[model samples]
Each structure stands twice: as structure tokens, then as C-alpha cells.
Target: MRRFLSLLVFLGLALAQGLSEVWKAVEVPGGICADGSPYRFYVSPGDPRRVVLDFQGGGACWDAATCSPESPTYRRRVEVQELLLAQGIYDRLSAANPFQGWTHIFVPYCTGDLHVGRATVDYGGFRVHHQGARNALAALEYLFRNHANPERVFVTGCSAGAYGAVFWADRVLATYRNAQVALCGDAGVGVRTEDFPGFRVWNPRLPELPGLSPDPEVYQVYLALSRAYPQGRFAQYTTLLDGTQVFFYGLMRGERLPSEATARAWAESALRAVTAPAQAENYTFYLAPGSQHCILPRPELYTLRVGEVAFLDWLRALAEGKTPPRVRP
Candidate 1:
């Protein structure tokens, strides 16, 4: 059964990859996707570390014709059942790609282009895919079976992806070694769990938390992953909020919903995320003087000129053996 499945899967993958040169639309499995089809990310394989599977989101309820099982989106999400791939933040041990000594996988959860106010209630963009991080992690796991024994593996996002970066990285890091991860948490997600484990968050020690995002597993994942490696420290940071909190993504300003208490909740999560790490090497946060969402997209908004670039540098430092500052968030 395994061998046949493997052959079938391999053939399917080959067919999908080949389609890039020839076909466009294809059929899909039943009950697997909303549209009953699959898509692929089109990333090159042979990675030593986990694969970076970015999930593009936008409340785009594309018709069956718009998306299909044989498409890049579906293939990327499903491929890996038979391979040695894993996701959710991992050490970029030089082996993944002989060319790039190190490169982290960022499986952002947001699907469609998330343009804040321009959107409407008809399309609850934020709510449509709040748990994109979870899917990204799952895809990573699916791709890298070798991820089970990581040199290191991790997952993160950009705008709505921050929560995913924090939650998945902390969970996998707490357990995996040589782990360093970051999320450009654009819209600030709120994290709170009533009965399960809390999340491990990292951002600069700004005057306030970004917003409170409720999570059911990030914190728990952190504790579980961290329990295996007790000495690993978390590398994190945040930029200053020059009155852009509400405009960017506070509760009062849902980046999607908008609310003051909501923004406060986000800030609260920021505080908890930094402090969530229990060990000496655990949580760390950096509060840039003034910053807002998508510095990578709009670097001009950062108090520290190189907001997003600096964050990636920190990830590199964490991977290599330097005790990058987790700062006092």
C-alpha cells in the first residue's frame, strides 16, 4: 500500500510539475478542498531544512474553475506526504541548499492580498483566514518528514502572519534545537488561551503590546518544543507605534475590525508573548522607536530605517550561534 501510494504520489507530483510547462487547469480529489481541488507553491525541492510554504489568503472563494486540485496551490499544500520535509521554523543547517548556506522558510497564511479598509464586511478578510499560520505549519510538516528530526525548522508570515511566526516558531523552538524565527506580524494578532498552553511572542519592548490574539496551541507548542531544548533563547523585537496603532491594526482599528480595547488586547499579547518564555534563554522582545505594518513592503514607516531587514538579520544571528538580543520587551 505504501509503495503504491508513493508511486502514485510521485507520478502525480511529476505530472503537476510538468504541467507548469504545458497545462493550466486540472481536476482534484473529493472532500479535500472547498473547491475540491489542490494547489502547489512551486518551490524547488531537495531542501535539508523545512520547506517554506506561504499560504496566500484573501477570502477569495474562487470557483472550481478558478482553482483546481492539480494547480500549484494544491500541490504545494499536499506534496511532502512522501518526502523529507517539515515546516514551522527550523535551523537552516547548510545542507538544505548547497548554494544558499541558510534561508528560512516563510509559509505566510494570508492568501489573497490583504488591503485593510479598502475591503468590506462582505469579505471578512482578516476573519476569513485568521488561522493561516496553522495551515502553513501543517504544510511544512507535510513536506519535511525529516523535519521530525530537525537541524531546525520554523514557520512565519508577513502582515496577518505575525501570530503564525510567533506561535509556530515558539512551539517548534521550545522543542527543536538551533531554532531562530521571526514574523513581520503586520496586523498584530491577539493570543490568549483559557485552558491550554500560552504562546511565545517576540517583538521589541515597546511601551505597549500590539494587540491580544487568542490562540489555542502556540503557547502549548512552545512549551512542548522548548521542553526538549532548555538552553535555546528566543530572538524577537518590535518597532515604536507613532500613533499608528489604530490605523494599522488595533482592536479599535481592526487593521480589519478596529477598536481601542482590541488594540489594547494586542498590546497585552505582545507583553505576554515576550514574557511567555520561562527559561533564561526563553522570551525576548525589541521595541523599535516607531513602526507600523509591512516594513518590508513600506520601510519608510519604521523608526529604525531598516525595520524588516534588521529583523531578518536577527534570524540569521539566531541560526549561527550568536546570542542575538531577545531584549526587554
Candidate 2:
């Protein structure tokens, strides 16, 4: 009976695969990786009119110490590429996933540039190609040409990818004029203006905010996008105490890692600044209590709760044009 049940489960998965298109890689000639290989993306078809574009995240590198060939940040690009080729949390077809039936596009990050850089730089003796923005644009153009007119779109990413999603929300909205768009940045908050002096290295053309300084924080970027597109919804999620962000910030500042309590305080303060204003009514956030870095890639994505609402349910409400409660634990 056990063997029979196992057979039944295998058959069920096979049937599901038969109905849904498996993630397939497609190369973009204009997109190039940091190592100079052709860039590629993975696509799994569902309801073409409803699409979920996910940007893959690793770490990022801007200077010699971080971008060197032997640096751990540089190696993350290879790991991210390998993971994108395998079936993982984002590729699951479980009923718990709000985007189970939506068309999925996985944008791999291998440029060591957080999917926003636009230049090639020589770091010490190593030449690092920082063409992340161009690669993303090329893949987006391909989607616009082949799968135009999506009615609903969700742009999301974890860690570095989360920054990409928030940073590029305006461009995504511009590409799909008729779509009801939503942006979710998981574990991508807590970035300060000073943490990003390397922005000059990426040289991305950021959105214009009238009163903001020339170099703005990531939260400010989200605010700017929200005010610019009132018709769209914006959401962000992160652990109250994210060690990964704390470590990254420390590295950028050349200091020891901040305490978890200090990190949580910083996150809360930044979040309040963004969500307190009347103009931020369309923006919401979920801050869970933990030292975890990302929520979307874990089982918590389905089981995690904020008050009386499940995270997945809250996300579904956002996609359905309903304003769910803002959770900050």
C-alpha cells in the first residue's frame, strides 16, 4: 500500500507537469553575465494575461575586495544560476501559492550588480561586467514583444532581487500600461543612502523624486514609485532582525555587525517613515519577528501569520485590489 501511494503521488506530479509548462531557459543575445556568458531567463507558462516576474538574488559586489574573482559575492552568481535551473520554492505548484496559476518568469542574477548596474568596470586586476540593468531590460523587452497585454502583473524578488523589484517598478508599469501592477520586495529594505556609494559604479538611471536628494534610500525609491503610480499597489516584507542585511551594512561601512535589537530598531524607523504619510496609504508592509533574511523562499511563505491573516492571503488580497492590514510584529 505504501508503494501504491507513492506511485499515486508520482503520477499526480506528472499529471500536473503535463498541464503546466516546466521552467525553460531562454537566452537573450543582448544580455551578458558578469563572466561574459550570454544571459538567460526561465519561463513557465500559466495564465499569460496574469504574470509574475521574479528577479533572482544573490549578493552584490562593486569594488575590488567584493568583486574580485575569489570573493564570496562573486561566487554567489554561479550559485544563483544553478538554483534557478532547479525546482525550488518559487517553482512550487502547491495550492498555498497565490501565483500558482500565474505565468512565471524567473530573471537570474549573475552580474554581481543587484540587477541594476549599467556599466563594466575594472576592479584592480579583474574586469567585472556590470550590465544588470541592460540584461533585465532585454528580457523585459522580449516578454513585451511575445506576451504583450498582461492584465495583472506582480513584480517580486528576494534580497538583492527585492531591491531590483522595487527599483524597477516604474519601468515594469511602463511596459505593461494596461496591467494592474503590484510590487513586493522581500528582505530588500534597510538600505541607506550611504550604504550605496557604489551606485555610481552601477550608474542606473533612477526615477525622479522632486524633493529627494540626488542619492535616495531604497525606501524613498518605493515611495517615489508609489506616488508616481497611485493606481498600483506596493508591499514590502522583511524580518525585524535581518542578520544578512546587518552584515552587508557592516561590510559597506567597515564596522562590526549591529546587534539584532539595533537592526530591528532601524528597520522599524525606516518603515514608519514610509508608511506614516497620507500619500503612503497604498503602500503596506509585513515585518515578522526573527533574524531571518528572506521569507518568500521558506515554508513560512504559506504558514506565517500577521495577526489574523496569513501572509499568502494578504498577498492575494493585494493582487485582488483589496487593502489588507499592514503587519509589523
Best by TM-score: 2
lDDT string, candidate 1, 234-286, tens digits: 43444433233333333222234446665565566655654465454543445
- List runs of model 1 lying over 4 Å from the truth: 1-39, 42-138, 146-150, 169-228, 231-233, 242-279, 295-313
TM-score versus the correct structure, for each prediction? 0.47, 0.85
Residue 296, candidate 2: C-alpha displacement in angstroms: 1.5
Candidate 2 C-alpha error for residue 5, in Å? 30
- Which ranges of candidate 2 are over 4 A from the true structure? 1-21, 74-89, 193-195, 208-213, 256-279
Candidate 2: tens digits of C-alpha lDDT, residues 1-329: 99999998997677556533567667787788887777877777789888888887888887888887787754334334323323334645677678778888888888887788888898767788888898787767767876788888888998888977877777787777678999888887745535566788878656555555566677777777778777888888887767787667656765445655556556666566446432577888877877787877776777888677788888888777555678876
Worst 10 residues of 2 by lDDT: 78-87
Whole-structure CA lDDT of model 1: 0.36
| C-alpha lDDT values of all predictions | 0.36, 0.74
